[model samples]
Target: MVAVLARFLVPLNSLLAAGGARVSAAAESGKARHPLHAMVAKELRLWVATPTYLMNTAVGPALALLAAVSAAVAGPQALASAANVPGVDHDALAGLVSAAFPWVLGLCVAMTPLSASSVSLEGSARWVAQTAPVPSAAIVRSKVAANLLVAVPASLVAGVIASLSLAGGPADAALMVAAPVSCGLLASCLGVLLDARRPRFDWASAYEPVKRSANVAICVGAGVAASFAGGGATLLAGPCAGIAASMAMAALSVLAWKAASRVSLQDR
Candidate 1:
């Protein structure tokens, strides 16, 4: 019986070894083919490892969605009345609705505290990524992917809420989703670009780079300015506004990512 068992054990070991080899090969193949996916996964894992960062990331979008829904229910007049300001007289209601969704979505994504400090978050170990053989484009793309991974889902939620609230038809609902998604994409690109250009390697705490950094202010300010412009375009373009605005944002996102890829990642 011992001799029979030993013979079987050798075959079993050989089978297991073959299976392991296949799995290892597949993993390496995947890594080689989709490096960006692996990098994005790493970025996401970093967020998860840091409970505070993860909580803030999830909470920001939730609050923004809550605010958006509240604003929708309250209506423009009630909002202005709450602040003792006159009702929104100039902006059309439909346009206001269109603008409000993207406004919140952009603000939420831009305020996520991920992209603006993505590189800086590396701290003293920042040299590892900067010194690696990976292309800068790949680095920026992974950061953008991780950012969109957080923001795009929230944008969809906001879009669905917009559609259920006031959208007239399928086209309207699509525009609602598309416009906010585009805003998220653009915000991610812009935030990454700003941080890549000016990474603050000197910081005592995470807050220094994540919240108090100049990039944070610039990102938030850009999001606000975009909301105003997007709101105006939605007001003026009537039915096609969302489509046009999204296209323009998409273009700008491409430009921003290109610029970011060119940035030199080194000390300071």
Candidate 2:
């Protein structure tokens, strides 16, 4: 038993030592940069290197845009028949499209798991981060910001594409943009909070956090619920419903970020 333990412990210790040295060297070199900027850059590099993260971020918006464009090509008659909105008139179909598009875009933005992955990635580097002189709040904020940076832009592009393809007016276009951007921010913040609530540090693969984590299911459920809520709000409140939902989501995001910062600090 002693021999077996030594065999494993010897190499494990060596690897940890090497990793620590590398982390320390990098920290020294980056001392001149703000910790938040450095952390954000690190998270961004990790995301770019991971193909699965890239795919998850891109697929949602791409599919939403494709569906919007296809619906536009199908015309009002097809949309009315599909939606069962009780009228085949241009106005009814246009209203339905305008109302539905924001929900779809918002849901797509919410499906992004970049924030969850950022938290998980930090698990491997928590020791390094703790040893550095950076505050826990900066670390948490950087992770959330990195995910938002990617998710928000992707959602906005999808919103713009959908609005243009569907022939929505300037107001509709603006609402569409705001809905997705706000949803992405909300999703990212919520993801961080959820992960902080139930963090898993023991993982063999990067995919484990985003793909197999319980947080994934929670985030997906939240996205679906928010999408339904947005649709319901639009039905009851008209085209400006998305703006209202965005406002509520923005407030929720601020709260979630505060919670995440607190949770991350405790974990540290």
Candidate 3:
């Protein structure tokens, strides 16, 4: 439990501390606290400084280049064969992929275990944070923001590469990236909620959350849903669906955090 808590808490604390310090420096120098100021402050620093942020940003571009290289070396047919999924219009799919380069950026960031880390971070810092004047919602919001900051660039890079490589229309390409960033934000929020109830790192307790297939299914299902929605022929429905999904996820995350906050107080 201690180890589990440490792993979770240490990273979060470090992130918050670093972010807070930057914010503080700015505030001390001259800036006034803006609305959502604390959250924004934390987010900006983490985006530039965190490993997750860097990884998220890098993965999309790297993968896009690889996909492009593969397309170049193998040719369109080769690219189609590599895809292995039948019935897709090779050119259209390629176009879609190229246009959606930003999605890759989102993907890299979104793929991280945001949910898994939720409890560990909270558990580790619970004593201090709970005692502070800050609201639980504020803490939860900060986490969500931090993850979003990281995931946005990651998704953008990936989506752009995919979009540009495959010849996706500019609008389509933009959505490809935008949808993932929105979804990634939602996922990060959900993670916070999920963490609320997690038992302190007991292998048995941890396994249930870790091994659960529902999270994976939800993400995959979201993609499929987006695809179907896009096929509806409405101008923006598909992208809208992606955005809606992200909002839904974000809502869930908030609910989860609220619940967890209550639980924490009760336990105390």
Candidate 4:
């Protein structure tokens, strides 16, 4: 009986030791990783692995490119004919469309997967995150960063193409660059805030939150309103108005992010 007990105890002790080593290694690695980097990695992995996210990210750029190519192929004659309509200067119309197109595309790109869907996708992970020492604010910021990572470059590409078509000088090019980036930031912050306000973790599909949620419509509406407002401002005030609008949107984004951070994980 004593021999049998010793044999059992020996294997049990070995198993416990191996488990302890693994736990220690994991803890050490966790400590070594920055919270923001880890969160961004996790979010990117989700975005890459998920079909809905891939579709959401790709659709905007694809549409923008297609429209741009079609417009370019149509030549100035088509545009000029349309510009012949009352109150539409061909140059101004071209510039307005050029500036507004990229901004709207960037806004849509940021709005798609980074907002309600992101929060809902976390689902039970929020519980795990809440139990961890990590701050919810950091998590939120990381999501915003991940969205910007995907969005800013796409927006920049579209904006540069549009700016070239406008034939505007350096200042117009600068406005185009700054405006989309600011719009992307605004969309990201708004997304997180909207999700925090009405997180829907019970969805059967990831696409539901991204495509079907009320927040999507709200965000899209806001984007449209902002684009119109910015275009109007640019019409009245010149390219500087675009810069001013970007600045204003960026300020609002910061404030919205701050408010989102304070929201309870229970809400997520």
lDDT of each: 0.70, 0.72, 0.50, 0.67
C-alpha positional error of residue 133 in candidate 3 after TM-score superposition, expressed in Å: 0.5
Q: Please, what is the TM-score per model?
A: 0.75, 0.78, 0.55, 0.77
> In model 1, which runs have C-alpha deviations exceeding 4 angstroms?
1-33, 67-95, 266-268
**Candidate 4 local lDDT, 34-138, one digit each (tens):** 778767867776665565655665565455445445545654446556657678777666655655554554454444536546776776566866675777788
Mark the 10 consecutive residues where model 3 has the least summed lDDT: 227-236
Best by lDDT: 2
TM-score of predicted model 3? 0.55
Predicted candidate 3 versus true structure: per-residue lDDT over 1-268, tens digit per residue: 2344345545766866876788779879998874455655544544434444333333433453454445445544555566667788886655444433334434444455344344443334456555756666666666656656555565565555555544335555556555556556545655555555443433333334334435433543454444344333223344445445445545654665566455452232
lDDT of 3 at 77: 52
Q: Comparing 1 and 3 by lDDT, which wins?
A: 1
| Cα misplacement distance, residue 23 of candidate 3 (Å) | 7.0
Model 1, 105-203: lDDT tens digits are 655655664687788788888877878678888888899899888888888887777566555667666766776677777778998899998888888
lDDT per residue (tens digit) for residues 1-268 in model 2 = 2344344554655655675577679878975657687788777766655655555555665565666566557754566667765546766776776667777778877886577656666666768866767776787788789878877777777777667655357667777777778878887888888877777778877778868888877876787787778778876886677678878888998998999888744444
Tell me how candidate 4 scores on lDDT.
Answer: 0.67
Candidate 4 ranges beyond 4 A from true positions: 1-31, 65-113, 266-268
Model 1 global lDDT (CA atoms, 0 to 1): 0.70
Please give the ranking of all candidate structures by lDDT, highest first, separated by commas.
2, 1, 4, 3
Stronger candidate by lDDT (2 vs 3): 2
